[model samples]
Target: MSSAGPSPVRGGWLDPRKPFKDGVRPRKRQLGLALRDLCRLLHSDEPAETGRRPLKQAEAAKRLGCTADELSRYLNDTRIPSQDFLERLHKEAGTDAATSGQDVGITLEALLSLHTSALAERQGCEHCQEMSGRIDSLIQQVNAPCPQCAAHERRQEVRRRQLRRRQQRKLAIRLRSASKEQQTRLRLELAEVKVTVADLKAELAGKLATEAGLRERPAAAQPAGAQLPVPRRPGDRQLSARDVSAARQLVAQAEELDGSGREDLAFTLLQRSTAELLTPAETALVVVQLRCRERDRLADDLIHVYGRDQEKQDVMAVALELHEAGAPNDAGAVLRAALG
Candidate 1:
């Protein structure tokens, strides 16, 4: 007893009977409850139909143009009927009542409304509660510092720095072992890559300035139903002659880098050139040209072959490859050439 164990914590938690502040009801529960009420009303015995036979499940299903199992599922709340089904059901119920000379006092519209209300009620209480819990967790996380997380992040940063240092060391060793000619070629490629990167930065700055200018312009009023012209991004603009020339020069430099076995640097330069120098359509055309060149190379591999059947098979395979590469028209042309 000795001080009653610090007067046992009382009434700290929320009361279960207390209503939620938002007053939002779970849709599924509401729909289920509504369906239960409807089922009861439909299945209830009528005093006016005392001498008449009750509607059997099979008969009801037949009238509704559904299987007996489907009707049973609907009555058991295992399945909800579609609007069309509900409408048909209402008509059938009315017809049965009329034939039996009983007033059921329910309309198709009323049944449809009940169904719609049930569906509308289907927003989940659990989902809202989960969202609220997540928000509270986020707020708590934002307000507090987690020591374990901080330590983990520190360890990760240390590991990353160590890995980067190791990579740099390995690259330095490789460069030291490379031939003089290879080193000179690599240095030149590096300079070219730097130049291309600088060009890309300048182009990006110019595009941003253009976008800012457009944004500052006053909005013009137009007639109703008239659409404004869609603004084009810098990348979408046609490549100028200067751009094409620069792209060609970059491509030539990249080829030299590649031939010198500095493919990584070559790829970097190519990417920069593509971004800063080529229009979308021009890039696509370049891709098609490269693909065609590759196809021709593969075709040349089979040129020395003597078998017509083998050549036809190889050509058909190439056509299929072209078709898969988004050049169905080119694929057809290849097939036609093979036939010729």
Candidate 2:
């Protein structure tokens, strides 16, 4: 404790002549400063008292065949020049001295070497090495698949298929149930149409009897060749029994098509029945009922499917039509339930 150890160096305790540890590289700022200093030395006039003037930055850029901005950026260490540009710069700086019969200077080579060394030092930096490692890890991660995520995706796909099958089965069952009910309803409606047709025939016969009685009373006052004009009954445009039977057959076929999921064909058949066979009231009732049933089925399917906004739109359209056709209460309730 009494004896003093070797006196500390003036700047710090570390020896001035000691070398750095292995794999050490100069920092970017230190390298940049060194490069800038070398640039100044190369670009300055050779002798202080000789009255020779160094080229201005613009003139120097002209000699090097580059823009003043580019040269300035290179000299300030803000940009790294290409190898060809550096070679041209070196040649341009030395060309004047060689032509004037003066010794070419070492400054140009020194600056180029400093710039190259600075680049090398930056490339070898610890931060750069760490960045390189991270880039490689990212590349490997991108190339290789994760087993857990892959398995999870596979399981999700399987579950999706299973759910779709379940929904389709449920839809098919509902379609069968609806078809049976439709058939029963159509039979009952056909019986009613038959009864109505019978009543219309009876009414038409009564009208003919009255017309005959009036014609008989006027017969005494009429000429021999003149014929009486027949009166038209209200039920003259009503569907006949044959037309009703045809409509019933078409309805059955349409329901079969609907059950088999050929709804487009079913609708086409229904339209034909409406246009050619069923009376106006019968057509309206049948079409409305079919449309309502189809809308209900669509709603059920939409509940379990993806991308069903269009189906919902179709449901709204049908509901609106039903409301316009005089079932406002039923249509309003359907719309409310659907919106809910």
Candidate 3:
């Protein structure tokens, strides 16, 4: 007690040598430094236990559900980490530091902003880079063209194409071993997917051309004998018995998928079912079946498609009647249905 031992290191975690010791900025390199510092601090602060050895890098990586090599890349700014990994790190560090009476001085908001900037910058698209790290104006003209928006749309189209190809391959494999009834359903689904692919390809090509300043001139006026396309409301178009039956079967499949916790596929099936004309009764049945978060958007689309007042009223009335009759035969089914 008489002789004073060397003073313990104070605030060593905030060493000036660290890259983000001053502050965390919304940049890839800065984020990497911050993450590195955070990992080091957390690892150092972990208490030693009896008969237990801790390898700092491995333990830290294990806590964040990633490998040591991945962590090293993240720390070196050689690779960008996903949003989920960043979130996990923030949560773990916050919880651990709080218990140890230490402040890591990092925030999730800063990390996410950095991530967004990093992604936009990584794309190397001029418009995307220009739009990065700026708050976009909320007021956009209805028909105004945005190069950045077009870039994002094109990226989405690419992703959709990849997904469509993957689904097509899966369907092709299933068709070989599927029963006749299953084959019929699979073929119908495949045909629908093909039509969608064609539309997507056409739209993507138009977007690419527009971006490349290759817009085509308007076509010459059509002949007088050519009939203009007639616009019809949702309920105005008639669906055959075969179409109606197929829609019902899709609805049943969607319900089964939903029960099995496959909500994404279920919602897609629901969208496919509603893409065509449905009678008020069938629409009501779909309303009773839809339980996903996208139900509101689907309902709005339905209202837009079934635009006439009479048709809208009929859709609502049928939905209500089904609710009253316990159509799905489940307790509180209506309460959980899209209409309710």
Candidates' C-alpha lDDT: 0.51, 0.52, 0.55
lDDT of 3: 0.55
Error of model 2, residue 268, in angstroms = 11
Candidate 1: list runs displaced more than 4 Å. Answer: 1-178, 219-237, 240-243, 255-340
For model 1, name the residue pairs that clash: 27-121, 27-122
Top TM-score prediction, candidate number: 3
RMSD to truth, every model: 30.0, 22.7, 29.6
TM-score order, best first, reads: 3, 2, 1
Q: How well does each candidate superpose onto the true structure, as a TM-score?
A: 0.25, 0.29, 0.30
User: Residues 1-340, candidate 2, lDDT per residue (tens digit)?
Assistant: 0112222233311223323334334433333443232233234345664664545557566767788777655544335667687666556545554544444334555556555655765567666556545755897899899999999999999999999999999999999998788667556654554564456557657877987887877576777897785764322334345434544555565666678776655555554344433444344345445555564443233222211222455345545544667776545654565665
lDDT of 1 by residue, 232-339 (tens): 443343444545555455556655565666666555555444444444333333334444445333222222221122346544554554465587765576566566
Cα lDDT tens digits, model 3, 178-277, are 5465546545764664465455446545655664442233334545465444322334424335434554555666556556665555555555445443
Per-candidate clashes, comma-separated: 2, 0, 0
In model 3, which runs have C-alpha deviations exceeding 4 angstroms? 1-26, 44-55, 125-128, 131-340
RMSD (Cα, Å) of model 3? 29.6
